[model samples]
Target: MEIEGVRTDRLGLLLDQFDQAREMARVRLAGLGDDEYLWEPVPGCWSIRRRDEAVTPRAFGPGEWVLDKGAPDIPASEYAEVVRQAADGMTVAKIADDWSVGVERVEQVLAHTGPPEPDTSPVATIAWRLGHVHSNFEGQWEWTFGERKDPGLLVDFTPSAALALERFWASIDRWRDSVASVTEEQLDTVGFSRYPHSNDAECPYVTVLAGANLEFIHHMAETALLRDLWRTRFTTSG
Candidate 1:
């Protein structure tokens, strides 16, 4: 559990933060049914439908669900804003100290980076979101820590919420185990992850961690909002 060069105590705190985020995701995904999990609020929304379901004309792929379309634009996170305000000066220690609120509460206040692109953006279902997160987690672990030369190996595309959640936590656990062993010098060392899919391969390990944290925070919020929209929109229509 020791991150090589970071003070053991500080590493513990960082891991605790990660654990909080993961738990928040689990809670948000809990108790979803096939109806709720696969419901698409729009005509072209990407979701886990039957394999024979016709692909939305706007979406790019044919599968049990709609996978990614455009290159995912990573945005500055609302959680990062909290970190800034919490520090009031941008120091990591102060930011950590101020991040005591629950992750769910953070989701409520934080907004996503850009306005949605109606034509280009695919409305994702809960099942897709969980699977996507799980895949990203596994990919990062393989290239960042494991022996896999290609980070994309063993990508999963499970179609059920319950099954997707299981894989999500399993992938997350492996990722958590990998980071627990990273050393302080390793955090600053570029190419530590060697993840080829993004710029993280050339960036410092700590930078990769920051990006991963942002992903968990913002994507979870999006899924939660989608669930709310499903309830409101579908209920009114029916």
Candidate 2:
């Protein structure tokens, strides 16, 4: 079916791009099993655990599931401070060379390493990552475009992989319906979504849509890479 009310080719293209990214996410989710989904390759890794078994110190309110502590991506502002302190204005390239890793690897770690903890690093299990993206995308849609007034309250880090995939696909379906119904004027309007997590208060509605798509793509890629690493580590060991 063709998308309606798309006044410009740009909007049409953006919607198409979102679809492509969503498909990639679906492919990544395929064949994920309960064991692999909740596997923690290392100690102290954040993952979905039973209510009785949950160990993360951070509280995410009353829920059947809890997000393992340590959010992905050290805040950029914090990371900048760390870089200044460690290397004293050295370029990213210098940091990469010093670490004996590729520049991209250095950038990722510098930007995303978990906060300092004693003998424990932040590692997210597949289930946690999936739950995060699903909740984020869905919450944005709910607060920005749907009936929900509070996005933060809508969070759910599902304990099971199957449930996370279900939520994700449901969000995708809602997204397609929402996108199909969007009018040109709505895209042009500012503050279309009152989502407090983003700069939506100052940006055009189209920007929010674009930003959400970027989030989906990157998180999906991260989950895919984790799956590959899991396979490699287990396959080699087995």
Judged by TM-score, which candidate is best? 2
Backbone clashes in model 1, listed as residue pairs:
4-183, 5-184
What does the lDDT come to for candidate 2?
0.69
* Model 2 TM-score, all chains together: 0.70
TM-score of each: 0.67, 0.70
Per-residue lDDT of 55-77 in model 2, one digit per residue for the tens?
Answer: 86553524777666543333443
Q: Which residue ranges in model 1 land beyond 4 Å of their true spot?
A: 1-10, 48-66, 71-120, 149-153, 234-238
Task: Give the best candidate by lDDT.
Answer: 2
lDDT of the candidates, in the order given: 0.64, 0.69
lDDT of 1 by residue, 1-238 (tens): 4567544554566677788888877787778777777777677666544545646433222344445434333223334565444444434443333344444444433443555323445678776676567667777888877775443335545566677677677888888888999888988888887765555655678878878887877789898897777667735533
Q: What lDDT score is found at residue 84 in candidate 1?
A: 45
Clashing pairs for model 2 are none
Error of 1 at 238 (Å): 15
